[model samples]
Target: MPTETSSLELVGVLDELTPEKEKYSDALKAAGEGFVEAYNIFQDADFVTKKGWKSELSKDDATVHSKNLSFGHVFALRTTLPVPIDIAFRESFLNFDDLATWSENITFSKTIAKLTDHVDVVHYANPDVAVVQSREFLVARIWRKVDDDIYVSARSVKLEHVPTAKGRTRGHLHLGCARFSPDPTDANKTTIDYLLSIDLKGLIPKAIVNLTMAKIILKDFTETKKHYANVLASENAQTHELEHHGV
Candidate 1:
């Protein structure tokens, strides 16, 4: 019998080849797709999501590669929870107000003075580490009234790279998007597609980076779901009580 291989070992096999974009050809390598060759090697490999949530991650091969390595990861997770789409959208994606409450690492967060609606620049500080105010994010967020679905696409941004904060590691997330859609068959079911594409353009090994990403996401998968479920249930009970009293 074949030894049960881990995802990291499979990814290590992929780390051997180097991208030779200079000698690019459609057969050897494509022009527009960044790091396509790297991600393409694991196209068939099986991956486990946070809490076994059945997320599928695939590369979006069309967009031009911005970083040295070019690729985009497309991930989708579908669940039939006993909650309406609007509630799901609010609790899952639009819960910025409750973000610090739900996430254990987030010490502080603030919305930047914006020039327009639906675009938010959020600054995040992680106090667990010795350094203060460690991370920041630039996001474009929306809640569509027509479909009652919520969508957000975000990318990480850095102000002045703090060299003194050696304890803090520089992480890279090239692209990310989230989509919350309602299930057509049932009014109470919903599906969330959280997609990302990361090719860390640094000295760190891709396998290690991959491992870290998986762990952080896995932590969120269980915690976020439970938090939302409880909050929604409480709100629902209040709504029912008010309706019964004719309020």
Candidate 2:
């Protein structure tokens, strides 16, 4: 049973949270329009601009085409959070075992094998993709913690040999990882860069893939920005409450 005073305090916290949301949205809008290109390395397909999050999309065979083969580079930023670098690195990128804790896109993840202390071979399923009238499959990503960032390299693993209404197919490996480090200007804030160089493989329509390519690519980073904003806002609110109560 909560008291009226506590309820009033909760409402006040929401008030603080709402304004922070607006601030974070503005920051992300600016980031999408600026500082996006600093993450791009691939010359041809790198479409990332400072306009939030971006990805370059293409197919191996455009004509006589199948959605089975497509590859590109993706760049996204998780910014405007005042969390420390180490915490940001762990929660945003390193903590794969509990990925569903922070990432909305990844619904479930469990460790299939532990290669070492820093590396986790994982098998994850995405129900989000299954509902799209698209070919569904299981993904196995290798998570390795580098010096300052975590590297997540994955390929489509075979859930089944033949294609079925519910079966898996072969996939390829894309070499790149998200890097994390301290912000040069602000010690309290952290910057996150997600660089995905993946060749998405499966059976689907090339036209469909091309049509929704930008949305699919941007989905990863869009979630990242939202998660980042919510994380810091919640933290700031807690800090405010503590000070208000003289705790």
Candidate 3:
């Protein structure tokens, strides 16, 4: 598994939106949709051609070459829970295979097919490394490394439901590991040292195409974060009141 580390220290009310285990389970579905949308943008012929990514694929066999490309993207999302929240609840969602599937009619590419064929899903839940599922599958496992360690893996699929308040939702998928570091000072305000690396095999050298796709994924997450933040704010206020009253 490929790994990179970065620190992210969330501030303001954001710091209190600690994720429960169930939240990760819910987010997995949303993350999957984000991943798919991002992949489509990356694979668009016009977008690829305009950005010079087409050159990476064999001109004589664009489909074959494109099909063999190893490009993959992963996303790690973290939210801080209030002090009173149970960590066990948060860890429950670490088992990757528990994610909900948004659709049964989804199609995958050859490259994705190959990776899933060898994919494994394991979580550090206890004495046993729970193997939720294995074999070639579109979405890999969800994992929570030992005590704030970096979690790395790749996945492809959308499982989480998007909030209705966000308006009509778009399909987006996330295929990457979740890295968590106990330290602060990471680039993305992540408490757990984390890195969402995207393998730019066929898309490398096509800087424009790669960047455009990256922007789409980042933007989607940015908006998603806004929605999460809004929800968190309300929750935090309620919790604070309960705490003040010793509830």
Candidate 4:
């Protein structure tokens, strides 16, 4: 949501909001545990493309891999964006309320509650794909800076405020994490690693689910890369205008 390089300020806001921990203890705990689990998965080289993972999609420098887990099949994607890490972090993690505007797969997204500056209770829906039914998620999301990288983690949580909508199946997000880091070689580039596992709780066929899951994720990240490029171009144009006007 921030237009400037203010990720550190976001971290400060997280620290200042620590006093409210007691109020949202359950949600925070669930979200934090999800973060830790996701971080471990991201750090495990064997859990990624190297070991049991089967390559699902790989094109234009974006790659997705899948492996069977106890809860569901998990998908991990890695890609580089032509935008800085801060911008990628803001758009992908902080600005979820506006996700459906640019993301084609998501039909709607809303921030039900802001537990903290870095944590939120969010609800979002995806339209039916192929034989899969429309699915929705009620999740607790938290994002923070760890070391020099930014991580956003989300896990499904039951809340009275969010109930399943008519004709839509609820999806349990076992674990979802997105990591954003500087590309090292280019200041204007960022590398992102994403991991997700979800169980759509309904009478859907496993064959169809598996067939469509990887393609959906591939489209999601491909759209994300394009959206980030557009955002960066728009920002640069605005900066150029300001400089031309000597503002």
Winner by lDDT: 4
Of 1 and 2, the candidate ahead on TM-score is: 1
Candidates' TM-scores? 0.56, 0.52, 0.33, 0.88
Q: Please, what are the lDDT tens digits per residue for candidate 1 over residues 1-247?
A: 2122201112122111123311111211111122223234223233213332233232221111112222444333334456677787666555665677777645444553221233333444444322122433332232223245555444554434222234444444454445566778887776654445544344656545454344444444555567768878899899999999999
lDDT digits (tens) for residues 1-247 of candidate 2:
3332211111112111133233222222222222222223312242224333322442221111112213454433333456677666656545666866666565555654433333333454433443243323233333434454333333443333223334543233242344455677877775554443334465556544444433444455556556766777888899999999999
Candidate 1 error regions (>4 Å): 1-69, 72-80, 105-107, 125-149, 158-167, 198-203, 243-246
Candidate order by TM-score, decreasing, is 4, 1, 2, 3
- Error at 112, model 3, angstroms: 16
Query: In order, what lDDT does every prediction score?
Result: 0.42, 0.42, 0.31, 0.79
Q: What is the lDDT of residue 82 in candidate 1?
A: 60
lDDT of 1: 0.42
The top-ranked prediction according to TM-score is 4
List the candidate 4 regions with Cα displacement exceeding 4 Å. 1-23
Flag the better candidate by TM-score, 2 or 4. Answer: 4
Cα lDDT tens digits, model 4, 71-109, are: 578888888778999889888878888999999879999
How do the residues 1-247 of candidate 3 rate in per-residue lDDT, one tens digit apiece?
Answer: 1111111111111111123333333234333333344434433574334432222221121111122124443222233322112222233223223322211111211221111211232211101011211112234333323443434344444324412112222222234443444434443233321123343222225454344334433332343334335545777899999999999
> For candidate 3, what is the total of clashing residue pairs?
38
Off by over 4 Å in 2: 1-83, 127-173, 205-207, 210-213, 243-247
The true-versus-predicted C-alpha distance at residue 44 of model 4, in Å, is 0.7
